[model samples]
Target: MTALQSRIEGHILTPTGFVLGVLTLDAQGRIADISGTPVATAAVRDSGAPIVLPGFIDLHVHGGAGHDIMEGGDAALHVATLHARHGTTSLLATTMTAPQSDLDAAFAAMGPLCKQRAPNAARVLGVHLEGPYISEARLGAQPPFARPASFDEIHRLHAMAPIRLITLAPEVGGNHALIAQLVAEGFKVQLGHTTGSYEQGVAAMRCGATGFTHLFNAMSALHHREPGMVGAALAHAEFAEVIPDLLHVHPGAIHTALRAIPKLYCVTDSTSAAGMPDGDYKLGRHTVTKCMGGVRLADGTLAGSVLSMDQALRNLVDTLGLDLADASRRVSTYAADHMGLQDRGRLAAGAWGDVVVLNRDLALQAVLVEGHAVRLN
Candidate 1:
């Protein structure tokens, strides 16, 4: 039997701006229509005139809600549910620097689950292989398992499942060629966790590496004389992901990047500690302690974040003074554009009915993935 269509009225946010109207969704979960005039026949599902924005698309989230992606299966599902409550409708299931076998197991478990989008849970777009192929000098919280990129290993991982993004150091031997190959294979090559020089980063960009992972965190710094990866990323106007918890990058630096790189977008880079009380959490093989608004390794080096997407949105607006529309682009549209997902990151007639509803206070009121409202409480 066909389910009833839903009509929701709100101040709908688009790429350009907001439109006050009624949005109708068909049972198949794609948007049917959006009209300023209310349809009298359709049943109203939401009518409070909440601020409805396109569901956030996180490209670099590691884990959340006490479940790391390395645990796979139920952990992935749990993380998805947890982030959905905080208004993330879709996210890449990100992995950490770990053994090849361990990373393979994580991807193996998530591949089937990605095929099956759990109801009301944040949809798993694909796998983001963050490490085991990154730089050694700027490893940060990544374990010693990091290595130079290899085509055979890359091919093996891609054969395991669809790898959406891979982070590698451009200066690594044979990596420039690897970046070109990955980009040709429909993968988004992101430079990160590297001690590569500015000229090396620029060379990688020319070779089709389109993004930088967690800009300025794992990559090289911007020296006045020689701006390393940071300078190259800013100079080329490539898409760069940033952890906006106000801890990873300073607000002043974020403002500078925003002015310099128009494609700069926000990511949580959140760990299993996210949505959990301050305590010990696992980021891959290493145990991280969450405390005092930050997660850190035993040596006090910064780990992944405890930030939620909703909180990142608030930080961009309340802390950084970005307008609502610009902040929306950072959290949603930019990531979608980078991932080549045209059907998402905007509320259009043919797009999936994914939305995050917030009250005037910018608190998350509800989240809808494929027109199904997720349970917030």
Candidate 2:
């Protein structure tokens, strides 16, 4: 059989658990079957064999390889290809808090690329509009162009490219009143960059804002009496995004969040410095520098991260003490389920043949997106 119709062997990670077997891919780039026998959980770590897991699905991505998503015009293509090499098979091109004109130009350039993914690049599932509708008081790393939420403007950008997810501050610019309406219109709204009270956050959730963006950084902190946005998320949110780079959120706090939120997932929130040497790069309208493994602005505020999905996975297992199976879910399955993508994140009959083959050390050996092998250097 040709390479497209392939058979991959490893400790295959399935919905229930890992199995020692071969995963067969059909001609249509779908998983035809997984034939094998159940293996002990300990074998996953002790066997020293190749490991096959579902391809990572990053819902929040800004850029990589010295490219920022807001740069537009083939920037997303380059960023997607860079992350695909790091085992991210699918991602959302995340934008920053910028002016309407800048956003329009960016969307015009990126909208078409989302529909037609470049070869060797991760599938651009859709856009994740991260700003132009946030709280000015909490503009962490984002450009200082925070404005009130606008339904009209959202529709305009959505027309340019399919905006699958949005990160907004529900308390700003009458956004609290718009949550239910946005959710009703089929948008996956996430709250972030806010100075809202815990009660205000809970109210927004009830109004249909289902997720929190990068929990516990720019938003209000948890207090015993007031229980700010972080408290609200811990107590109420079913799903939320977290940057597991250890700098964004402490490992202790991440442990608490994992217990509180059932579907707590990892996001890169990466900047243009990802996969590049330490130097200055563009993040929206600001110039950020990558130094000592983190990217920061001139004022020493973290602009974004240089983290990749593969490194994030290692951090979860090696630093955070999560088992391989759980870490896989955080890096892949949970995000897919959050986005309602059943066929992309899991290994099941008829699902897309997106796989990540790793060595015993959990490093990327190879990556296949839709049954096509992606080259990794």
Candidate 3:
């Protein structure tokens, strides 16, 4: 008989959206068998309450705890670890708009970190470049000096490293051709930080913009007659990323969006101030303050958020009254599916053994990455 490596006996969540009892993880860090009947094994572990769900994936996160990914070096990896402990098993270290040299340096630095196979490092799924192509009118927290997207600039950045996803303003100069070129290069383009009209946004979507970054935060607001970028986002159900801290977007808007968008994912949009005391921090070149439960600028513009995916999941179920099955999809399954990630978001035979065990109160009890238990409460 083959030796058991680790077995988690609890309510298992599969990517196709179902919870069931299953014996997970065989000896080689892969799921071996999943059956309705529980099996006896030497490597069994009990999750105890709530449910054992797939590990959350955050395709859009700048930083967490007290570290920003733009800070680079081991600090970025350290921040990734902080979020991993909070239930994110896979994430893309996002960057803000910066000068060309700084942006290039950040991307170059991330290459080795992305390639490293370290236990503590959350699986880095490549970089999410959130600017240098966004509109100045809806720049929000992005630096104003960075050059906007040009076809040549986009190609240069793409050649620097494997940029999996990028966020830009549809109406920005040169964005139309840049978007088409990026799509041809196999990059996932997302629209964000824009004051584009509904028609411009629709044009972007048609040109291969497959997603929205932090919906309702940095884009034009929805108007009845004009129906700005927000309207375009809500009108199309295929692509949306909502920061469900109940801060970046209000609870009411989130509910409305959940109904409107066929495919929606949750992101923290968290800043360096996360997991720390209410205080000041830096997001690229701009200074941000964390107060109450939200982060903002001196002028009271919402900077990012201080939320984690575990808390976001709880808020979805408790505040929004979504079931575990649906809420799990927002943070795990939907986000994974959105990013075209095939193996890490589900619990099934041959899928990566990334699991999160949460208790009744929605607190993370433990987390398993690649069949190895990493975080325990």
| 1-377: candidate 3 lDDT, tens digit per residue | 11234776566666544444765687667788666633222112233434678888988888877888777666567767878889888888888888877777777777776775457546777889898788887888887854567666666766665678899887877787678878887889999999899999899998989899998888888999989889999997486899988867789999899889987889998889988898999887788999999888899988888898899999998899888778888888888887787777777788777788876677888777677676442
Ranking by TM-score: 2, 1, 3
Residues 1-377 of candidate 1: C-alpha lDDT, one tens digit per residue: 12333877777775545667878888788889877743221122234567778899998878888999998667888899899999899999899988888988888888876886787689988888897787888899998888878777767877766789999898876787777777887889989999998999999988898899999898889998989999998889559999999999999999999999888998999999999999999999999999999999999999989999999999988899987778888999899999999989888888998888887667998788888888898
**Which candidate should be chosen as best, given lDDT against the real structure?**
2
Q: Backbone clashes in each candidate structure, one number apiece?
A: 0, 0, 0
Worst 10 residues of 3 by lDDT: 37-46
**Stretches > 4 Å off in candidate 3:** 1-5, 16-20, 37-50
Cα RMSD (Å) between model 1 and the true structure? 4.0
Among the numbered candidates, top TM-score falls to: 2
Worst 10 residues of 1 by lDDT: 37-46
Q: RMSD of model 3, in Å?
A: 4.2
Alpha carbon lDDT of residue 159, candidate 1?
A: 74
List runs of model 1 lying over 4 Å from the truth: 1-5, 37-48
lDDT order, best first, reads 2, 1, 3
Clashing pairs in 2: none
